[model samples]
Target: MELKVSSRSHGDHTIVTIVGEIDLYTAPRLQSEFTRILDESTTTLMVIDMSGVEFCDSTGMNVLLSAHKRLRERGGVLEMAGPRPAVRKILQVTGLDSVFTIHEAVPEELLAAEPQA
Candidate 1:
């Protein structure tokens, strides 16, 4: 399946919604989106909405790790929300569940808040 990536700003956070499979062919697209968001947005917090992702491979995981590292280096945070069972298992097996702040869902407060000026 084709990978789809999009983002929206909410308060101090940027919520990136991703769908479809993330693998060798799709990971670059995800990486491109992350690079764009990092370079353009001023927000220090990013929430990755992973509820739509049905499959994610090692390349996809690496892309996520790279984004997380980059965010941390700039004193920002990268959060994962609503990962499906398979992705969640991969994270757990890889020990990345401990590294990332995984959420059951994107926080309601963040979605309801007005974007920061």
Candidate 2:
């Protein structure tokens, strides 16, 4: 399956919606999208809506971690929203569940109102 990414701005944040499998072939696509968002300077809060992702591999997790680290370095944040069960489990097993601020779903304000820790 192919990876698909879409986005919308929520005030000072951007919500990126991703679908399909995220593996070796698709991780770059996601990384590219993140680069574009980071370059555009529209928001500092990057909310990834993974509700449509069916599978994610180690590469995918690496991509997420890289983005999370980059955002944190700049005093920004990377958040996961509505991750599928498998993806959630990977995050838990890898101890990354604590690294990211996760939400059951993308909240109304793109979670900007909440403190980013």
- lDDT against the true structure, per candidate, is 0.94, 0.88
| Stretch of 10 with least lDDT, candidate 1 | 108-117
Q: Candidate 2: where is the Cα deviation over 4 Å?
A: 111-117
Q: List pairs with backbone clashes in candidate 2.
A: none
Candidate 1, residues 4-72: lDDT per residue as tens digits?
A: 999998656899999999999999999999999999878799999999999999999999999999989
Writing each residue's lDDT as its tens digit, candidate 2 over 35-80 gives 8877776577888999999999999999989988887778888899
lDDT of 1 at 106: 90
Question: Which segments of candidate 1 are over 4 A away from where they belong?
Answer: 114-117
Q: Enumerate residue pairs that collide in model 1.
A: none
